[model samples]
Target: MKIFKKNLVKMTMKMVGSLALFLGAMVIVPTSLVGSHQPKCPDELLK
Candidate 1:
């Protein structure tokens, strides 16, 4: 059982956690700054 444990497993878990945090910020912070710069469509919608 002891042999099953490894340092690489711990490091991999930490890396996955950090990557999740970075991805969360990417979706959240940008939306606040973007505000109302969205594009609008009209003529195409009528067809």
Candidate 2:
């Protein structure tokens, strides 16, 4: 019973870590892409 409980806790932590990574990437990736792009402002405006 102790072994089973330890294994279950380990598995749950692994799953939660994976889910946090997935969610972090989902938020970070799109924001990074948007930040990297130049806006469509005219060259004259940039000068």
Candidate 3:
């Protein structure tokens, strides 16, 4: 019973950590997109 409780707690923590990381990435991605410059490229560069 004790082992089961410990395992449950570890799993819960892992899940919460993953959720936090995903949320952080979600917020950061759009922020970088908004701050980026327009496609600065010539016709040759497009190839």
Better of 1 and 3 by TM-score: 3
Please rank every candidate by lDDT, starting with the best.
2, 3, 1
Model 1, global lDDT:
0.84
Clashing pairs in model 3? none
Which stretches of candidate 3 lie above 4 Å from their native place?
37-47
Q: Which candidate achieves the best TM-score against the true structure?
A: 2
> Candidates 1 and 2: which is better by TM-score?
2
Q: For model 3, what is the error of residue 37's alpha carbon versus the real structure, in angstroms, after optimal superposition?
A: 4.1
Give candidate 2 regions above 4 Å deviation.
38-47
Candidates 2 and 3 compared: the better one by lDDT is 2
The C-alpha TM-scores of every prediction are 0.54, 0.75, 0.69
By summed lDDT, the worst window of 10 consecutive residues in model 3 runs over: 37-46
lDDT per model, in order? Answer: 0.84, 0.97, 0.94
Residue pairs of candidate 2 with colliding backbone atoms: none
Cα error, candidate 2, residue 7 (Å): 0.3
Question: For residues 1-47, what per-residue lDDT tens digits would candidate 3 score against the true structure?
Answer: 99999999999999999999999999999999987867677989779
lDDT of 2 by residue, 7-38 (tens): 99999999999999999999999999999998
Model 2 earns a TM-score of: 0.75
